[model samples]
Target chain A: MSTLTSHRTRPPAQPETLRARRLPAYAAPAIAVAALALAAAIVYGAGIGGPVLVIVLGALLYLVGLFAAANAVEGRRAARNRTWSALIHSAFVLAVLPLVSVVWTLVSKGAQRLDADFFLTSMNNIGARDPNGGAYHAIIGTLEQVGIAVLITVPLGLLCAIYIVEYGRGKFAFAIRFFVDVMTGIPSIVSGLFVLAFWVLIVSPWFNDGRPSFSGFAAALALAVLMLPTIVRSTEEMLRLVPAPLREGAYALGVPKWKTILRVVLPTALPGIVTGVMLSIARAAGETAPVLLIAGGGAAINFNPFENNQSSLSLYVYQQAGSASKYAPDRAWTAALTLVALVLILTIAAKLLARRNRLSR
Target chain B: MGETPHRSADAGTGGTRVTQSHEWPAGASARVAEAPVSTRSPDGSGLGGGGALPRARAFGAERAFHGLTLAAGTTVLVIIVAIAIFLIAKAIPALRANTASFWTFEGWFPNDNPPTFGIGALAFGTVLTAVLALVMAVPVAMGIALYLSHYAPRRLGNALGFLIDLLAAVPSVVFGLWGRDYLIGPVTDFSGWLNKYFGWIPIFGGDGPYGNSILLGSLVLAIMVLPIITSLTREVFLQTPTANEEAALALGATRWEMLRTAVLPYGRPGIIAAVMLGLGRALGETIALALTLGATYSISFNLLESGGNTIAANIANRFAEANDTGRGALIASGLVLFAITLIVNIIARAIIYRRREFTESAA
Candidate 1:
């Protein structure tokens, strides 16, 4: 490594007078203030037709003046650091600003209509400008559809996790992992198409009836496919963390393998497993594409997922997003807010449950 | 010594030989419980051991339960695989009997009669948008991760990390909503400005009054995926050895140089995995693309033009309206998307596993 040359050896002696030291220290802040003033001036001048030469000349003079002051106050190292910090901070601000703006816009746009009525009523048979309508039916459909998905995914994911973590060892284990990896990456839309084809070709061909076009059950199947991998992967990690001694003790006690897994291993990993399932629920709760394809978008309250078209909150948002009517668009924004709130609630509940389980254990 | 009675029982009978060789745990209670009298009669006649009938019944039940759990696990794996294969089989018609090859054809107008649909445009749109999203997201994500892991004051970093987790939980549809009304409109205006000023550049050329361009879609995707990359990268960055950073700092290097030398190199594998995860999300992204991308079917290299559509977006947009043949074709496109995403995820998992192996071996 190259040896560093100390500034102490080469530099002039430190200023003994208070004025010299204080002046340089004060100069940095002063230059910063002047730089802001010049920027403001340039912006103001640009707002109007400028005397082009004067404006350009003024900007150059201001920059040079500030540069000299900055050099006087701060060493080159500090100046460069500040410049870099500003740049990084600006980029961060840029990233955050859009997100904050979106939230602000949503609140401003959607808050006027968000109320008890919005959550309790449906837009059933409402025309384009029906202001009385809400997303109750869509919310119900979303809950039922995602609820079924949770039911289907949790058991399958848990069982898969059990196998992979507890029983897996050889080629069978490798194959399972490979397939889960594949399923993990399947697009939401593909799952929707899979459900659609399953209903249309495989199930319908035997029944000889019009294909099951729009139902919460169909939406659930699609979402289950989407949610299964997340739940499995997370639960697998949780299961793996369960201490090996517990399994060994159970085995030594003559407990059956399945009994040991169910009683000892599962209890240890239960909190994390529940958290995984809850996260998967939150994930599927807002999925739009599969529901849009399988559960046709409409306005109706159908508690039975086995029959008829079911519109979810997400699909409702989509429907109103593109509608020309102002009410429709406003309703869309409110639905978005509603969806965000529900998801937030679920996330908090999941965390609470996980913490409770951890404390109890 | 306590298992002596059961051990003799296990050794005595040739007819019960299978149980002797079987590797049941030799715990005393278990051996005593499991060592059994052979039934010379199907009736309750051969009682050489105490409570042999009850033990046999209980053991049988336990074995059945074990068998059931294993079967259930394998069944889930089978179901997922079966579903994928079944869908591909159902979508096989598009492969066998399309006018144009699905991979090479440019047009994606599946709704039109005679249905000329190819996935080239969709593929291009999908890969380009995802890659661009990665490019835009990864650096900022890494910076945020490093800041949270190393630079930010402790409480501030924790708070920011919490906020980032909250961002991750925000529904994709909400992001779509945010993108559609809030982001796309301004982005379109920005694109117009780019076209006005930097029109000489090929990338910034093309007139798009509505901001549903590839760039807009990519921006939305980048935003949606930032939290994942950030969280993963933060974990990786935090795992970097403190001594490495201290050594660099001891050499009188600036903070940036310290990070560049110590933190980044150590987290290379993690950053790669994080990028891959982000890529996976980008590949499967539906709602944001659906909302932001102008749902047109033309393929152009120009990002400014609003004609490109991703496979996910196309499947989402047309699946409901598609006829049987059209539905088949859309599913076929989904199969392609699924394959690409699957490969990406597999590679990511492999890298993660390899890293784990390395760390374990080193330890």
Candidate 2:
């Protein structure tokens, strides 16, 4: 055979295939199906209490089967790759389940109380048993509280950002940036407690007849505290993005520095600043704990934010959810829906604006 | 006019140059350079080439504005310190009369004659629920992050990423209601199944009633935290250099292998920071856990039981009905929560600080 091969200019055949072997795509699905079927039989026949067991067992069994089949048919490397892919896909599926389920439940249950009456009439004279009451007062409370928060937070946050990006340097700047980061992590409840201690307890007593009182203004202060750090951080990011050439050009134009900042820097960064402010507004608007603590949720309408109790949509939801009345759940669900809608709208607007800015650039 | 150039030029030097313009090295030359422009425009406001020269004031609108911003910036630090001081000042009276150990007692009946409250149970529940949430969330978040950053097609990745971000915007109270009503049934069933199969473990050890269990609360918390962890980790994973990934691929590495060698190693610190941030949020979460947890203030390790309570939740639940002493107790507990979150966030910030160039430049 060697002599004939030499004469024919050919060599002996190799025993193995040249390329690395790969299992067919169908192999994984087949194994997974087999594993899942076996899992169902074991779980159901073994008197498992619920579907959770079945799903968990099926997933585990499928993973094992895929890895084992791939290892045997292909190799360890391919098995690892397949396992990771399966894990990643399953993780995404798992996350999507809760997200979709929550949204679906909100829409389905919230629709029960999504009437015009729900928006128009306040619970001014309604009894506990009445279902005709609305969130009109709560809406007003939220708007004013959140509006005040935006007012306080925007100027201070923008100024803090300006100090950081324009005038700040060294330890003081570092300190400001660091504190802003720390402030962002403050609990909303803690912020509420702060306002409770400082504003409602200490300051309000000084104003009132030596009695601690709750008010929408106190809630606004707490929300402002919560919102300030967020606005500062986001505004700082946007301000940093303003190109240096623009600032230098303004300087070269002999424009006063403050005028340049007010006219050029601010106008250039206004859209992003507005986006940050709106997002903070949405966040402040949904704060339940702070308003609950400070405003002391009201049953009747209260237009004045300066004094007396007020209800926000979030506080209304919490109060209603905890009430023993039959119709309270519907109101609670609808309030939740409205809050979600409000927040999503603001968030969507901000994202769209950011996207527009990006596209135009 | 004389002081403006000195202040603007190399303001970092910290010199008192209001009266002495020639003190700055660049100030003299800058004034010299401006001589021609002023001469050409003799009617300009500065000298007006007229009799009345502008006052050489020590500060102007620019300096005042700078000082104003600096003061505004310092308000963050002031507010933070004020929160701590006022909370302590308020909490001291409650601590002075506590019948129970503040750190060790397991009950929270603070409205009594000699007020009795302790953070042990609340703190335990807070840490347990937050840790459980982290355990449940971090791996799934990482997987989603990796998928979005590396595996999925770009357009699909962008869409899913955007949707995930929208998940972050959903308020906690909405999540609370959803969890309490809709998620309760499935979670109860799941907890029952877990107890049946894994009852030996303390975490899964519970009998029939399991609707508002720690498992449910932690799962809800996980959902609340998922978007944050996912987005942060996605940002980090995306920042992994393309060259390193390509090098791994050139070495005949599989996609998973490349990720292991390149992406994961690069994103490790960032992932840690993200996880810490998620942990912080989970700890501070109030309304969601307040609704989902059964509000049972018992210090036990059984997660499958219909019993759990957190400090923030306790504050929200008890504050409305609390007496003055009770309010103080709640504030004290809030102080504890504040400390925990502060430590976590500081650690996170420190981790991110080390990589500041990476983050700031990306901004």
Candidate 3:
């Protein structure tokens, strides 16, 4: 008892100290600046590079400097950690460069033709020398094609999701799910080819009196095929997220299974479903190959989707970019910008709606 | 532990009650007459209520809904089968008409009399460009993914991740446009520099006129697939067990060492899956390659030369002016692309599914 008391009464021992050494916080920034100076001197003074080269060389120098300095100061392991950290950060920066350039180029070049004339008029009568053509018809075509695709895909996809989530069992359901995954990876261009073969080559020829004529409706068919898997997968996820307790509660209230799913599950998952639908729509709208293949892109303003050829913004961009005329590139840029804007708007709105969805949380 | 015997006893009683109800009269009216008595009691209640409940009257509606949904699900399968069948049906005629050795020939002249065309060059370019793009993209994508998942602060990571997702949402056609007009100059200059510096290497040994080359197309493809790989790998990295990470850190391992010891080993399958998925995308990319590649037809290995073509790009470029035979030939090429991507995706899915069991067990 005396020994225990003496030990308990002894003063607290000194805290153990860590032997690991760390560099100062500002060391990184200082080395970065030094590396930049060295790289600038080597690249610019030699007249062999530009800003991009300087940045690249500077990043290399910084990595080397960081490793050397950290190794001398903080030892090998810390040096490796620091080097890897710098590399990872620079990797992100390197990726951001192309993305930023893409966006900046679109805005700068696309803004040149962002005018009322470019928006309101069709490219029907625009000559090779004319700079006043617009994607009015293409915009209309994209909307109609995408709108029709949405109308076809949403119900089918929703029902498929319902089937998979609520009623699915055993191998048939597994096959459906597996194929859906496969279908999701089907190339957009291949989807276009499918439609071109099935619809434009075979089915639409019946409607066109033995001649295979392209129509906006054909484009809609291709887009529908592309949009189906995306919608089904997303809606399936959303449906799965609808809690089991909710279904159990509905069942406890004597609601039939179908009614429970229709009244309870669908309502709970609706916002998420809409978000998925909108996302698929955005993806479908940006498709160029299918529209290029089956729609037989027209410059004229033909509003009838089932009757005649129609242009889409993507198709228009592709067309204008390939055209020999000098004015076409500007039009291509503007149309590309328009298509991107449309897609981005839809995607953003869908994301926002998804965020608001209770089921998502 | 206390409830187990009680629950099992209740289940046994319930099973006996279900058997007793099955022994009841088969008539609906009789079952309905029996429902109230069984429902009123605490024991054996709801056993007869199974078939006699009002909800049973809606069975027809339930079956109809189920059938409808089942039909919708089946349509997905039908669509895939139809794609393969229709593509073959169209391609057969074109294949039969080909006079040239379709496997070895490099030129595409399906429009000519007797129609000589081949997928040799296109397939070569497709695989080459896609492989090269993956080579360029995978390391950097992994780096960015690691940064997002482990390196960056949480809020910064979230914001940057959102930005990367938005980058993915940017359309392919827009990327094509940018690559054609804006990126071409820099890529051309870079190509020249590579040719000048690395001219001794056969692949880099090229003369002038080096803008729309395999290098340019692969660069654009790399950019396009970077976000996909990064996002996927980031998710995988984020899922690294905190216990494993802490174990490594507790061993006095530095961050990089911890990643190498803990995170990477666990995330290898996921990384491969992501890379293969990216490869799939790069293989099937259309407009971007169409706009960027020089559209040449040869099995060239020169990365700095302005000569490369892919199956999808060739289809997109030639589909507009293709005749019956030409369209069929292009569709044939599309068939080849479809098969390639299918294999890639199947392998990716297999990897994911294999890993899924491990992860599920681990969790």
Candidate 4:
């Protein structure tokens, strides 16, 4: 009642003059359409070529036209606002064009070879003139290589997260955290180089005769190097998000910290951890450089990752595209599409799972 | 204690607990076997509510788990150091055998008997293309970020943001394929159009062949980097205080003025960080430029000519064919690329770190 009385007793104040007045909302679109039409006509009449020219002229005209029209009707402040708004909107449109174009191009070009034959056979013996071949070997290589990478990375990543979250203290923990971040900034090619120098040049050669050898396991090792930081970062976030009280409760009951984390924490954060792992897998799968450097791209099927060279989808795409054959481009496009599809599927699933976890929690 | 009432219900275990604690020295087991008293029930919420974990817990099991986790954590440091050491060990021989200045020469002939090579052209191309990419991408990314944060409806902004993130996830190799195959024609025409109109400008001065230019490579890189900058700047913009916005609104400031005064200033550091991160990505980008560029090794500023090469692209293009010295020179170049990226990433990290106080408090 008192609050109502206070509100009723308040006096209405005089309004002050403001410099800028907002133009009617429809003014923007009207000006944009008129400017675009004029730009299109002028370009067409002048015999100017390319959609880039048309789009650029149209956008420039729209900004000038909107500012002028608004200035005439309102004032300079409003005109400036109109110009900024137009520019912002045009910037968005420009940024979106390449994304739309890339996807459309991929789908149109890739759909040509996304057939059973594309998946069922290998390019082992396919001639430059021949149109029939598949990424069977490459697909097998990708799966085996990525599987090995995951196997090596996940355990290491989980343990690191467990240490950081459960037992790490002060400088040791901070050093670990800082370096993990630094590790993420290492270029994928550099990781490949590191593996090329260390694994293929030194370690794998030990297993074989003394001569350097490139193999899928070396590629997997490089991928694992790329993947570890990503997994650690994601697992760290998930572990951190596991409520502290759960740990305190477990500790109170004389549950050893490791058992508490294993039985209580990991289960709660598992969905998020899995999502992170999936994303890392997606990133690792798309890498061409690491595989090219160490895996040593091959044409035929090679299931043994520990021994000779193998091919991955990305390596295959690079190889086929570089082959300078007419049909090679088709094979390249299909392999790229397949890699993209797989990565996108994993990414989407991971994102959806993350969203579900957020909502459920 | 709250667990006292439940203790009688589990008296059968209570007898076993006395023997367990007696068998093991109380001090030796740390907090594990010592917690059967009043500690478990002090805070009242025990979801597990089990008879205090048996005497077998802690000690050996705890030490082993911590050791394993610590080892994993330590591996990150080990790997980074190992990479540097190995790169140096491989690159030193090539550096020593160089008959020419390794820093300034334009050509790469490391496979020759005397091994004459330099990273000047490749390094210059790397920085130039990355800078060009940032020039094209940063403004547009900022615009899209502003649109998402300020102009678009909530649902539309979210959908568009998701689409942009999807674009980021598209593999670089895919972008390379698209650029080399599909984007080449349009780029060729655009190059001609620019040269015809802006021929007086040195960058747009090239005549004759126009496709596979630095402009094309940079444009492709711009497209690749767009999402990262957009998403980051959007997050920073969204972090602007609501009170600050409302104050500007109450003062009858226009939307643009409000954003200029409040949001942009607040997001400046974040934007710089985002752009630098994008630059890092563009700098080290390999396959996309490898396929898009004409694979020349010169230091020209021309954006219309069919010529450009980055260190990463060169490595990818020539590594397979490279002899021992050639591979060593490539590793040397890789070291340079690594240093550049490390500097960029560290600076970006420092920028973000400067605002950590505000963020932590706000959270």
User: Top TM-score: which candidate number?
Assistant: 2
**C-alpha lDDT score of every prediction, in listed order:** 0.75, 0.85, 0.87, 0.84
Which 10 residues in a row give candidate 3 chain B its minimum summed lDDT? B1-10
Candidates' DockQ values? 0.35, 0.51, 0.48, 0.50
Backbone clashes under 3 angstroms, per model: 0, 0, 0, 0
Query: For candidate 1, lDDT tens digit of each residue in A88-193?
Result: 5444655676667767877788797888889888888788867768999999999999888888878878877777876666877777876776677677787887
lDDT tens digits, residue span B1-363, model 3: 011121212322442232223333332333235233333444544444332343223235556787899999999999999999999999999999999988889999999998999999999999999999999999999999999989999999988987787777777888888888888999899988878778999999979689999999999999989988998899889889999999999998989999999999889888988888788789989999999999999998999889899999999988767889999999999999999999888878878888878877976
Model 1 chain A: lowest-lDDT 10 consecutive positions: A48-57
DockQ sort, best first: 2, 4, 3, 1
Clashing pairs in 2: none
Error of 1 at B224 (Å): 1.0
Best by DockQ: 2
Model 1 spans > 4 angstroms off: A1-88, A204-210, A355-361, B1-62, B76-80, B95-97, B247-253
Encode model 2's per-residue lDDT on A272-324: one tens digit a residue: 88888888887888889899899978887889998889999999898888878
Q: Give the clash total for candidate 4.
A: 0
Give per-residue lDDT, candidate 1, residue A187. Answer: 76
Better of 1 and 2 by DockQ: 2
